[model samples]
Target: MSKTKFMGSIGRIFIASFLLCLAVVVIYPLLWMVMNGFKSNGDMLSSPFSWPRELNWQNYVKAWNRGVSSYLTISILVTVTSTLTTILISAWAAYGLTRVAIPFNRLMTTLVLGGLMLAPAVALVPLVKLFQALGLYNTYWALLILYTAFRIPFCTFLIRSYMLDLPREVDEAAEMDGASPAATFWRVILPMCRPIIVSAVVLNVLFTWNEYLFAMVFTSGGDFQTLPVGLTSLMSKNGTDYPVVFAGMVIAAIPVVVLFFASQRYFIRGLADGMGK
Candidate 1:
């Protein structure tokens, strides 16, 4: 083979090897967590790397009964509700910022993007006071509101970037046909924006599902705890029961893993166009 072609082949092989190692680094912990969940605490401590004595289904059952089920349900509700709202609100904001002839548009974009820079931890105390004042403390609404609000900036940025590349011809054609701006947005732009919408939804789902700080602080009651907080509580409650804790973790991880895998294609497609610019 030519020298250039031979070097290109070597480069490809080297890159592939690097990525394989990285994948193992990322995936092995998840495998270990799941595998260890099937083993007893004695087995975990004594022979950490060895196969389980048996699949300890009891661990899952115990964990589920000990608030994991309730925590999981609450997480699902918050994630679904907040993620859908975040996407809708962000989509409208993005569309308005992109399509509407609003004043101070540049300033608006800057403010929206600026949200990505703000630290959620920094606002915890103030947010706590505000929520308590609003009578939303220890409630689902606190978490739902926080999730939607924090995610809006990032989601709006992505959707707006994708929308910027959209052809104006369809919008103009719709306008000529006497469709109202809202109708055109609903029926026309939204349908065409599916890839990015899916991407934003999945991204928000993962965030809301895994988010701990807000969930922990906003909801004081056990009935309102999410997976991350619930898992922390589980660890404290069953401090010595490693298998049950691990089982709770596995339960917590399954939905996000399934979601990312299922929507990965659209997720990547959606981000690619926006991030490229």
Candidate 2:
């Protein structure tokens, strides 16, 4: 073989091997956690690496009955609401920033994108006070609002980048057909931006599902608790029931994992398209 062809083959082999190892590194811990959920405390302690001798489905039952069910529901609620809200607002903001002619457009873009730099930790104290004053503390609204607010900047950045690359002629065509701005956005732009929107939804859902600090702090436990905080609480209370704890973790992880895999195509494509733009 030619030298160039031989080097290309070597490169492909190296890349494939690296990706295979990376996949194993990422997937093994998740598989291990799932396996442990089917084990008893003794099995977990005795043979952490070995497969469970029997599938102790009772562990999952116990986890669900104890609190995972409620936490799962709350997480779903928050994730859905927040994801929808964030996407709508971000898409609209992106459309306005990219399409419409407005004064101080650069300033507006800067201000909106500037939010990405604001650390959530820095706002915790002020947010607590503000929420408490507004009678939103310890409420689902608090989580929904916080999740939407914090995520909007990044989502908008992504959608705006993607929108910038789209042909302006579509906007003109929609307008020539007597479509209103809102109609144009909804009918022409949104459908075209499906990849990025799906990507944003997946990302927001992952964040809302796994978010712990705000969930723990804003809600006073019980009904408002999301999966991450609830899982931590489960671990604390059932520290000895290793199987149950693992079960709760597995339950918490399943949705996001399923979601990413289901939308993997759109997710990767969206990010790639947006970044390339």
**Best-fitting candidate, measured by lDDT?**
2
User: Which portions of model 1 show Cα errors greater than 4 Å?
Assistant: 237-239
Task: List, residue by residue over 1-277, the lDDT tens digit for candidate 2.
Answer: 9999999999999999999999999989999999999999999999999999999999999999999999999899889989999999999999999999999999999999999999999999999999999999999999999999999999999999999999999999999999999999999999999999999999889888888889989996547898888877766643578899899999888888899999999999999998688
Candidate 2 colliding pairs: none
What lDDT would each prediction earn against the true structure? 0.91, 0.93
| TM-scores for every predicted model | 0.96, 0.97
Winning model by TM-score: 2
lDDT of 1 by residue, 13-59 (tens): 99999999999999999999999999988999899878898999999
Candidate 1 similarity to native, TM-score: 0.96
